[model samples]
Target: MWIVLMAESYDRLKKRAQNRRSDAEEAAKYIFDIPEDMLSDLSDDDDDNDPDFLSPEDLDDVDANTEPSDDYSVETPPSSHQQQPEPTASTGKSKKKLKVQEKFGWRKVEIKKVDLSWKGEPRQVPGILETPLKYFQKFFDDELLELIVEQSNLFALQTEGCNLCLTVEELKVFMSIILLLGVIKVPYYRMHWEAATRYPKISDKMGRQRFAKIKRFLHFNDNSKAKKSGEQGFDKLYKIRPVLGHIRSKFLEVTPEENHSIDEQMILSRGEAA
Candidate 1:
């Protein structure tokens, strides 16, 4: 009886061992049969605690997919902090008001009408006989007239400020040359030699060289003259010596009535004769 009992017990123990082995083999087979994607997902979950496991691309994708919370507010860029003001009808009116205020200022001028017609020659008049105020009122607005007056006054002040260091003879020679050039209406190269020969102060060689320098200062080259002619012929017409003389006579305190008369003659000769 004891021997039979031992054999049964041994058999039972062997069967239990075999069953445990079979169960272990079945579980391993099931695990191996799982899809590669499921296995990868399980491996990723296992590596969640590891900081080095996630790649930069993976982290970027995660950040991109995540949405901001409702409670969180993003800070605006410095450039976008200020809001732009919109243009409106009220603003337009304000701009017009500002322009008017800028033009007239607080003080106003009282203008009176006067007849200026005379039987005498206009050239003999002491001052500009025509009422500049009336002319301005007719041709332009008060604002425009104010601007013109301001600019003219400024130009007068500037011209009067220059000190001419030339001797009386040199001044006479310069004026005579300018007048001759105006009368003949010839280019500087042709007239310069003749003028220099006529005037004892100017040598022929010096006159020629000075002519080139003066032309350069006046921007009388082909290209600049052509460009200026296309616009208004301003460059060709604005000779520096004549302009300086006029400005000096009109604005300078040292200039007498004789100088003014000479300037008037020069103006007439250039404008009417030339």
Candidate 2:
């Protein structure tokens, strides 16, 4: 009799468990917006099978993965430009996401202006009212011009085995032509000497061939001793580094304006652009 009663109690417990599982599964199907494929995965004919049973954790995971409904209230935080939906009391997953966003989202509230005082005295150039050439000579002195002439002749001798005979006066005339070329746009350098588009100021100053030769061999620094790429002390502006250093030193001689702007353009003849 005792064994029969134990069997009856076990059957009753099994029936109650099956009924509870059926109600929970039915609620999950309606409450959660799960796909038909997922619903198939969750379904099982045998309620006693442990592996096929869906736990509370499985339901939470499925709920988290499902998309939110369209009935939630829209909210805008005081600091955020974007509008977000306010999670209803039932949406614990949305509340967690909102918390995460609130933790990380930050922005600048206000900015203050800062005033800087100049410590150096104002600079004055004596006789700056003189000719523009005199003021220009302050930067491009005779020593710099002589160095150019030396480099040009040396480069020509080393590479082409010919005498450039590039004198300081000839170099000055060459410089004038270069400045004038900037003002008068021409597609080709030889175009300036063409009869149809000839300028006496440019054509009569120097022969076309001489100008071409000087331009081809002009050097500010010795290329023979320049450091190669990937080597220590290699300079990107190896050709004009000496001239740049000289100009930098000259710039230090005069004080700069408290408020001024400098715009620069570099044109490369041959090799990579810096």
Candidate 3:
């Protein structure tokens, strides 16, 4: 009876174990079978018709054996939803520099008499009396003399009057002096001295002051005109004045021998007279 009982118990345990094994297998099949169909559907969606589809075989050329390289990169194309930047406008316009105008005038003056015998005389003919004659004779046939006269007149008009006021004849004389200096490329003071020496009637101090005033007026007028014309106003006006002053000083310093000659001649004449 005991042996039979033991055999019955063993049979029950084996049967229970077999039942558990069968349940586990069924559960595994239930889980795996559903995923298999889902996998198949995913594979079908990865065909050429799908723009985002890419196969593992396609990526096989990307060396699996080697470490990945960041040197070369793949970027997604810019989408229609993305915004781009616009260009800016240009502004670099330039203005032209102006040309300085010629300013001076001339007129024909009748000679009352010709002193032919005075040519070889110790008392030389004054430059005032000689210059026009020489110019008229040299450029008589050419238009140069007429042009000179016109320019002189224009200059007189441009710079007329004492800093206070100027008469027409005084203005003409001022213009003539400016032209003479310019032609010879001399300074205002030197030109003033020349004119004073030529015409003993003109006082030295008066001529000097006149030239200084004229220079200041010209400089101020030029700057004002440029400003009024909507041009680049004289940015260098202050600097230019100092430079012009230095130039004037240097010019006066030049030709020391010629400058001293007149003084030396006067001194020697005085000594001889004494």
Deviation of model 2 at 156, angstroms: 0.6
- Winner on lDDT between 1 and 3 is 3
Q: State the local distance difference test value for candidate 2.
A: 0.81
lDDT for model 1: 0.46
- Lowest lDDT block of 10, candidate 3: 218-227
Off by over 4 Å in 2: 1-115, 122-128, 261-274
Candidate-wise lDDT, in order? 0.46, 0.81, 0.48
Indicate whether candidate 2 or candidate 3 has the larger TM-score: 2
Candidate 2 residues 1-274, lDDT tens each?
A: 9788667866765676686655535544544556666675555555547776786788899899988779896775665555566654546555343342453656787878777777677766566477988878888888899999999999999999999999999999999899999999899988989999998999999999999999999999898899999999988998998788888899898776676776554664675653
TM-score, ranked from best to worst: 2, 3, 1
* Residues 56-150 of candidate 3: C-alpha lDDT, one tens digit per residue: 66678555656858898888875544553343445568544455344446779897996644333254334665567454344222242333334
- In order of appearance, the predictions have TM-scores of 0.19, 0.55, 0.20
Q: What lDDT tens digits, residue by residue, belong to model 1 across residues 106-178?
A: 6677889887555443444347566854543343344433433343334434445422232334333444455
